[model samples]
Target: MKSGEWDRGRFVGVELQGKTLGVIGFGKIGRHVAHMGSGLGLEILAFDPFLAPHMAEELGVELVADLGDLASRCDYLTVHVPKTEGTSALIGADVLSRAREGLRVINCARGGIVDEAALLEAIESGRVAGAALDVFEEEPPTNRELVDHPAVVVTPHLGASTREAQVNVAVSAAQLVVDYLQHGKLHSPVNAVFLEPDLRERLDPYGELGRRLGCLHAQFLEGNPKRIIVKYFGDIFDEPQSRNFVTAKVLAGFLGDRCSQPVNQVNARSLARDQGLAVEEASEGRSRYFANMIRVELTDSSGERNLGGSIRGRKGIRLVSLDNYHFDAVLEGQMVISANEDRPGMIGTIGQVLSSHEMNISSMSLGRDRSGGTALSVINLDAPEIEKLAAVAEDLMQEEGILWARCLQAD
Candidate 1:
């Protein structure tokens, strides 16, 4: 059964217990469904090429690298991949064409991934005995003929709708794609610290630090952060944008992910200065590490907080502030990794893995998804284990298979 399907409290085949739940797009709700389904004692198998193999192993799930492989192996194949340009109509006739007998299919992701017409044919032929869908390729797929079928169970998209579910999903995870988007999603990063080398070089040492920390704090903002104000201090004003221009540029560029176009150092500052913040301020760094610091005053949908930080070293960017929460971290390959459903021994699992590699965590941010889901955590570590970190991130993303995307925290 799909995650939304489970909480919806609609259909429960007592016979459904102990059945395998094959999922595509290991994301938020997908993971929720898998976790919740454990009461059924069902084996969880999934297919998601974008996910790393190690992450899957920890979930104790069987990972199928390819879609066809998942279909061939699963007792019930449920899809949760997104509805991107490439994913539209992904599992058309070709995918449905191959199947073992009595294969059940569920589509709680986007509607387009499965070929509706072909699915009906499979249902009629007994290749697929039952099917469930929450979304359609077309919002409210007008094709009553397909939706009205007896073998197919349908619902409007309701993945993270419950009050309890809402709070669980919106927690401290960097990307709440599943709780926010509801369905299969990629555990992708927001590219918070990406900029051209020349452009990055142009930013002052302190400004670079501000950019990284500012970007990191900005990543987990629950609601929209409409307005931002950046300010510089001390003798760092030797550059051309030392005035209002430099401040605006970083804020604008940082805000780029929410928008499509590039935000530059030129008008970026001015645009932010005029945002919704009733008041915003920037400050100087007083630490022994640097002469000054950058401070941003902003307002989000929820509440407001003052953000400050400074950078050190010749090339690498480090996190120097988290709203007065004292911590120092470099902005290179270093990562802020987190996981929830933090059961009694959840931390032990990730710790065991990190310990095996001798990786050291510089800092950590701990949180919980909800009452029952699990705990969420963020880890700041040295950049020594590059491939190892990437492997862990990939594994987490792949293992969930569109359920929860392992958001790689950065600054």
Candidate 2:
């Protein structure tokens, strides 16, 4: 109307009906998108490693096993995944290269999930048709080329900008405060453990240890958790309350930010159960070495990972054993854990990498199954940023003997 030109043919766009919509990360937002896309007569395919098959079936969405397969089959691909170590740059050149030609991309989720640079190249090469991005790797993105592309549409990351969303946020926050004040119910508690004053004095240290161990396991956890087996060793856990409280604490740590709901000691077990995870606890009268010890074993599709923690007399909390390797490592601050072959200069190589990055090592603990076998090194770094820690871990894994390196923010 403004240009005094009305050409229906020129404004014609592809019809979404009967087109396949592939949704990566089947969380709340992803599920909603799938439902809406289905209503619009679009076939839905989802790929989320953590989402159960039964759940997807109930929603009438076909769950694709692989990301590449989803990309190859879908006409439109939308991402709603969280930005994590595994998901960073998830839809990069490799995924785009394998996509169905003329695939239209949409990302209203977190930034850095789709490599913007790679997406731009794919568009230029005529592999990708277009893109609609609500988020970017950098807020107020500096990449003008991608933002100004003719086939691309960019938004200022306004996913929650609706009036209804604003109202919902305000209402939810007020309701949470009201519920907490009236009924002593905490939907989302900041602190890990919540206990009575008397119990706090006796069980605080043990609870902290359990939470730390769970957190450590979660950082490096592979696949969705199936079963969590927590073993209590020593006389300290003889009381029923002590064991129960600590078990909940362990779940609190393991499920921390992984769950959609707020996790506290009160609701951790229930939340774990809701996710189709089995919780088990065992008690032993005596520990092999320490006076008291708590071991958490998480079994997933990949394999089982076990971590043991104990509260030293003066050390507060210490990670005593990881899997079959036993050594004492302080369970606090930022840490870099690596599995490497037992060899000369391995420690020096790790140190040199950190030193090159100007990262200071606060403490180091080394454990091995045998003299000439694989070893685990837990090195504490003095307050390195998460980005730097991840880079350092990646650098460490590039070394000759290092098998894998994981960065842990224990704080």
Candidate 3:
């Protein structure tokens, strides 16, 4: 004990082998950290308001309902959440003050998620044993005293600076470009909003449905459009990410049909704006027909029209409603659609035309309000020639019973 710097007789340290680790956010990075801690024989507990219960169980973590419960039980705590209004100063004086003594905290997520002043108070008052801060409220922090504190360890924000991480990021960026250029696949998007993996999976079908819906409307219009409004119903309204995906696809379909140049999800919005077309969105959770649905309404000099679609369990993407007529038909392949009077021989007349042209009917569905009112007939065909389908539609429109007819080919 010559220098007297080391307390040789009273040495103490917290072992992580059997201790509890509390994770604030169960995002990608948080899950990785939890896996590492689990491998080290540490019990992992997590609190994420958005994370589902099954996800935590799958990660072998106990999901805590409250922050205070997690703070009081953990020997060590770490935060991994984005910097948002809801998460600003998430772990503050109150959380630290209520924490059990000898608790060590780590903040490597964002600067403002943890209050530095409250952390210093906890350290000084012995409420916290130590803190490892990789980020500060201010970069090159003005408060040097806190950084120099004996119980605190600081890093220069090099969290994602590893060589492997750099390579991954560069590859991801290049892949995003290649995906867009080569396949029109938007894997990694900049303008597209972020969504949880589960939510994305659930909403994938709707994106396709939205594109087809828009295409159907555009084909039906065959003229200049004044305005387009997209409506979301049921749980789809809760997810903001779905808005971008659906709207982008809708624009892609509509513009791709009308524009001479190729239109995709990335460039659809700009194209819509350049064409002096008004784009709007609305959402309502209430739906009398289905749990979730997307409707696209188009207004032009001619009139107003609406097309609606939804994802049904095993049925896949279905065109649920077109204007006042409601029908369930898969929006795929070559389709000949006709709006006509609810005549008894309407289906026979359409079938006779296809039979005479040697075009096989893949599937056909008819929808109408009543036996004597207006009706809609969607006939999927093996017919590929646009002229042949157009001839059939033209023939139907010329008939006394048919009001309007259109040929839509899906590419």
Candidate 4:
């Protein structure tokens, strides 16, 4: 796996919308599963007998009148209902027998949902279209029969592995329900959070911003945010000072966004509160980083997400902090800057390349390295002429025998 990659399966198609996605449990992940399903246009129907019908509607989910009906109608079935004494073989041959043909199944919630031996038989017999598993009833001693099956995609319980995913689950579970609640949007009822719409409206505009900031906090916050105090400081607050309240909301928004949950301010806070978190507020204070910063108190699930960044040149948000060190986060666009073997002017060659392409340097930052062999120069640009920029950077990295490029996608 890569820096942020986890074992979900060999990356394949994830389009889920428009299909009938039947969720067995309809719990936290199940609701999230449904939310993902809806995003891919899936018509969600959940089976959680313990929850009320109206509640399912509130989360944008439909509660099946019966489990068999859900099984019969769904094109894809994802088991979310946890394993219990009565449900040992919940997805045995009997259950699969009821499902329509070509029924794709996923079991990331827990392993016991599908009887291992039964699952293998179904897969071998072509009763299942495709299968995905993240857990096994017995962890290491997996069902070798199913493990070796190609259509039976398997992962070592990775539904809760990503740094971002774990952080969201922890924080969302800790937030105060009233501050900023989130839930399934009447499509898949799961954990429900109720909040005041006025605060929700106030918190909406900062959704993405809050999400990024919270992610930064999650990736960087040194401890578990089990008990956090969100504060709404500075000019952004109206007469209402929601320093802690808004900050907490941002954290929830961050959790909700990254996990692809149907997040809303209304439920963000409540989700935290339900998880037994101690949330507080600050009347007055100043952040050390940005002009106005929201400070978060967090505990690391593992070691901690070491993170820091700054607004670069002008509006460019560049990350400057990672782990214990701080450096300007700069990836040059076109042109050249070099950490050469300190000959006369390694910088001169880079300049020549820029001059020939008519590309101007927008901004640059250098990091400390060896006295003669290395230096890091990060440059900025005015225009992004793809061919000109890539050629220069590629040529420079190759000539220097360095791998100097990365691509990114935003959600």
Residue 339 lDDT in candidate 2: 88
RMSD of each predicted structure: 18.1, 4.3, 21.9, 18.3
lDDT of 1 by residue, 274-308 (tens): 32223244444344555655666655655665555
What lDDT does model 3 reach?
0.80
- Whole-model lDDT per candidate: 0.59, 0.85, 0.80, 0.57
| lDDT, candidate 4, 186-254, per-residue tens | 433333333367755544444334444455454233322445444443454443434434554555634
lDDT of 2 by residue, 88-160 (tens): 8999999999999989999998889899999999999998999999999999998788899999999999999
Top TM-score prediction, candidate number: 2
Q: Candidate 2 versus the native: TM-score?
A: 0.77
Question: Distance (Å) between predicted and true CA of 185, model 4?
Answer: 29
Q: Write the per-residue lDDT of candidate 3 for residues 1-411, one digit (tens) a residue.
A: 777677767667667899999998776678889999999999999986444455556667888877888899999999987775457889999889889788999999889889998888899999899999999899989888779998889999989989999999999899889988999988534455566787777877887888888877767763346689999998765766678778888887776534434566566766676554678988877689999899999886467999999888933888888888899877888898888889788788877777877889888888998879999998888756765877887777777788888888653
Per candidate, the number of residue pairs that clash is 30, 0, 0, 53
2 or 3, which is superior by lDDT?
Answer: 2
Ranking by lDDT: 2, 3, 1, 4
Model 2 lDDT on a 0 to 1 scale: 0.85
Runs of candidate 3 exceeding 4 Å displacement: 1-191, 260-266
